[model samples]
Target: MPSTVPDSLDGWWCDSSTEYAFVGFSYEVTACQSRSTLNSEFKDIRETFDGRYVRLYGACDRTGFYDDVIDAAWNNGLGVHALIWFGFEGGSEWKDRRDNLIDTLWNNPKAKFVTRAVQFGSEPLYDYVLDPSDLAGNIWEFKWNIEDLGIPVTISELAYGYQVRGGAQIVLDSIDVLDAHILPYFSQTASTGDAAWKDVNNDLNWFIDHAAGRKIWFSQNGWPSTHYSGVEPNSPDAVADVDNEERYYKLLESKCEFFKSVAGGGVGWFWHIYADWQEPGYGLYAESGKTKFDFKPRTEC
Candidate 1:
């Protein structure tokens, strides 16, 4: 059977949980903030964005969280790339968690319909949570078991991780898709405006050259609308304020078009976030639930 996931890499990374205080890389996993809020966000995403796919960081467990997101996305005519959280302290339970998540989705008609792909984990190598060899083993096992579900499987990682690590190569070999996170903001010389577009394209090219012909999907990419310094001392500062955020979005949109023209398709790009949260200034929407940038790309292609 043909895959349900789109070939195009146009999507958004969405987080509905309000508990993302960013305390030690953790967040509360609620099914959703509220019914009305979830509904509105899904609707806006469907109507406003050109793409129909959204990537969620977690499968949201079996509670109201997973069901609500699936229901909202399906009702809004959107698809999801659901991720299974890996790399917890006692990571042995990941297999069980993965099984439960798949079973949950398989049983839920709405979730099964909206879910386009299953991403095994997000940035496992970057956090040093798992060794490359071990992660590859887990991915191989998960892919083998989940292939019967008829959904594509992949893992998310930094573009550089694949170049320098063993697990990334294993992941690339085992999965149907190549999901990478290319954030220009994390580069040594952080880029802004048009320069940002160039930086991202360079990153994209690097991945393309190294991906060994696998379909590439940018699982996360975006510029923060605040001036907050990143985790490391030399990290790039986020673009300050709403106006610059709009500029950053336009630049990225243009770059996406450029990529499609040159790369000949079979790639995907998702912005880092759908809305702002406790991370200070990374959201497209402010904490007040208002859009931070009223991005109106000139070439609406």
Candidate 2:
């Protein structure tokens, strides 16, 4: 069958998430009140590169980062397709901040903020991670927040892992947008040349079959160019002898096909692209300023 990749992937993720997180949490993830990295990395890439969309979560305080990234993307022939913000603990604080942030972003003509916003970053797991009740509470709060925004809201990270049983039920009322968070293969399997790319493909199929009446996006999906714990490698280099370049291309091809056949058929979709991680080669560009393996994919045909 031919690939059914969405007519437009306009993928989105974060430079903040990648540069600052350490075993999943980075300084940038937590340090929302610091000086801006916006004018440099975020703005430069959004304007200079072919990057069409950029995702930002929380940081209502820095307002500058929000303005810079969106402004750069809008001014540079690109669009800030989504303005992703986070909700926490069913707290009124989160809702209050959500309103202020949305107002600030939308009010500024230079900011170019639209109703195209996402509610949670990784908040769905708030029950296990925070309060057991928070999982549902947060979702409800999100629905309210989205209704307030008068725009569609996406739950950016929906886990297939055990913590998210009844995953579809948990998010049904809270989100208009759903993304499958699938990360296949990592160090151990890839190092031994034993990893298969099938895991990611299977996860995509499982998500597609399960997510009905919901708009879907492979919100957090990709293979590490290298490897890490819990997340394995489906990289071409993992196989030593098979041409690495071809392997890389196949990986991208497969991902694009999955998005076409499965995700695009749903509601909306996005791919994760982190620009500044020097560790296991997870981005299209390395921190040292080189294209990781040269098989990078673009949004436009």
TM-score, cand. 1 vs. native = 0.79
- List residue ranges in candidate 2 displaced over 4 A: 1-49, 57-63, 81-100, 109-115, 130-133, 146-148, 161-163, 186-196, 227-249, 254-258, 263-271, 277-280, 295-301
Residue clash pairs of candidate 1:
9-268, 9-269, 31-65
Please state the error at residue 223 of candidate 1 in Å: 0.7
Clashes of each: 3, 10
Candidate 2 C-alpha lDDT tens digits along 234-298 = 45446432234235435544444334344324222233444434224445456677655544344
Best by TM-score: 1
What candidate 1 gets wrong by more than 4 Å, as runs, is 1-31, 58-64, 87-93, 229-239, 262-264, 296-300
On residues 1-301, what C-alpha lDDT tens digit does candidate 1 reach at each position? 1235344323322321210111011112333456576667667766675446677754344555666767767677777777777654655566666877767676775565677677777777776567777777877777676565666787777866766674366656667666778676667766454467667777777777766765667677666666664443134453455666567667766554454443323455666677667355656668897877664432223
Best by lDDT: 1
For each candidate, what is the lDDT?
A: 0.61, 0.44
Q: Per the 3 Å backbone cut-off, how many clashing residue pairs does candidate 2 have?
A: 10
